[model samples]
Every structure is written in C-alpha cells, then in structure tokens.
Target: MSTTIVIFDPANASHAALLPSFADIHIACIGTDHTIATFTPPLNRDRIIQYWEAQAADAVPGRRIIFMALAGDSDGQQQLAGYVVLFRPLTETGPFRGSVEKLLVSPDFRRRGLARKLMDALESEAKARGQTLLTLDTETGSPAELVYPKLGYTQLGIIPNYGVSPVDKRLNPGTFFWKQL
Candidate 1:
C-alpha cells in the first residue's frame, strides 16, 4: 500500500511518464465501472490527452488542479491508482468557485479510501485558491452520487435521463451537488 499523493507537474519527467496511465484509469473506469455511466465505452483517448496537455501551463496558479495518487506496483514502478481534478474558471470578476471533475480510482484500488483522500485534497486546494464553493455531478443512484453527500456536498437535484451509457445506450440520470469550501 505504498502511495503518495502529488499534484500533477506537467514539466516533471517522472510525472510525464505516467501520462498514459492517467488516461488508462479513465478508459478502464468507463468501460468497467457500471456506476460511471457518464461516458460511453471506447472513449476517445485523444480527449483525455488533449485536456491534460492543455493544463500544462496552468501548473502555477493551478487553475486546473490535477491530483494523482501514485502507488508502487509489484515491480516498484509508480502507477496512477487514482486521480481527480478541480477546474477554476479564469473569469476576472465573479464569485469564486471551482468545478470538480471525474474522481477516478482504478478498480483494483477501490474501497481503500482513495476517492475520499483525493476529494479531501481537492477541497483543501479549492479553499487555498480562495474558492468558497465547489460543484460537480454524477450519475443519479450511482456510487458517486451516494459518496458526495457523505463528503459534505449537498445534492441540489437530479436531472432525469441526463446521459446515455456508451456501453448499452441506456439513459442515466445525473445528480448535481455542491459544497462550500
């Protein structure tokens, strides 16, 4: 259980090495985790790659705070076990707020508090950025929808038939939640 949480540093060579694993986590979750019904399976890998690469310049202000939990594998290589991101809008004037992106944990790492750990760091990072409110959504009745309330987020409402499952094209509802940092 050797794990260390670190903010993604795009310029860091070690961090760059895990780029594929970072993308792998998402694809794996979408394909296997029934609870993550937001995206259809066979997701465009380019989407994750482009988005993460675009966040390279935001490393300083951390406008897009990308946190990755790296754990030692059997061969002692650090693998991306889980990750989550907080995106802060660049608007010059307005209420400070951030959007929580997908909180993904490798299935092998589930039930180990990695999601909670990733989220705790996200909330703390949000506060440090002077953000008082955070918002996100998950599939209604999904595990994430259940976890948010326990993590201090209040569910605003559910959007019926909010997404189409890529796996089976089944419609899934979405739950919106927020927390005051």
Candidate 2:
C-alpha cells in the first residue's frame, strides 16, 4: 500500500482533508448494490451532509467515535484510505454496547489486513470507552463477512429483505453479527 493507515481521533485539528477520506470510505462501504445489507437510513444527501458535518465536529447526539486512516507518505495533507465509525449508548448499564457504524478500506489497499487493523483500533476505542458488546451487519458474500468471524464476532441472526437490490430492485437479507468485548 502506498499509504500508512493511522488511527486518530477525528476531532484533531488537522481533519479538513481527512474528512473526505472518511466520507469516501463510508460510501464505498455502502456500495451501489441496494440489496446489500447496511446501516444506512433512508435520507437524502443534504441531511447526510449535515449529519456528517455534525460528526466531524463531534456534535453527534450520542456517544460516538470516528477514526480516520491517513497516509504517512502524504505529509498528512492527503487522505489515503478508509475509516471506521462506531457508536455506543451512554445510558446503558454494565459493559458498553456498540454498533460498528462503518468500516471501509480503499480498493487498492485491500487484502493487506488494514480492515482488521482498523477494527482493532475501533475495538480498542470501544473497550477503552467501557463497551462490552458490539454489533454490526454485512453482506453474506462481501469480503467483510469473513472478517468479523475471525475476529471473534458471533453470528446473531439474519434479517431477510433487509436491503434493496441495485440490479433487481429487490431487498436482500443481511447477516447480523456481534461480539462481546
């Protein structure tokens, strides 16, 4: 890979260029395939744009953390790869519960275990925040499907017709997975 994946808080001062990388990763993670199971809510770009702006400012309503994978080669001026965004409720009691909001690695940078590294960083963040349970969903055929299991995520259940298909315009079921940290 041409870029080094560095995990840092999005609240850092030098996050202007880094924001687009995070946005792109979020988009790539949710491909054009509507049938792919995802966590996207039904909203237009304006709303999402506003929401991300809030995220960039760490102004989201709940307990959330955003991480960016940047390039050590680009002098910290360019965004090289993907990012992971996770959320956990503060009202919950023992052991935190989390939703792996987003995880994506650039296509050119896949298969090098960056995703795992990002997840590791995210899990560490979650653990540090006192979260004990985390949940995320992925398409059955996507490369991500193999990742969580090896990382110790248990398959909780499958939700049929959970996503809309891009080709046929039909909904496809997605596999839900969770891990107890």
lDDT of 2 by residue, 81-148 (tens): 76677776566364468888667776656677777877888898788878878999976666677788
Off by over 4 Å in 2: 1-11, 29-51, 57-62, 74-78, 93-95
Segments in model 1 whose C-alpha atoms lie over 4 Å from true places: 35-39, 44-47, 55-61, 73-76, 93-95
List TM-score per model, in order: 0.88, 0.77
Q: lDDT of all predictions, in order shown?
A: 0.81, 0.66
The digit string of per-residue lDDT tens for model 1 on 1-181 reads: 6887888987789887776777778788887776463446568887866655666557557678889988887788778999988888867684488899879999989898889999998888888878878999998877787898999999999998888876678887889999987
Alpha-carbon lDDT of model 1: 0.81
Error of 1 at 8 (Å): 0.4
**RMSD, every candidate, angstroms:** 2.3, 3.6
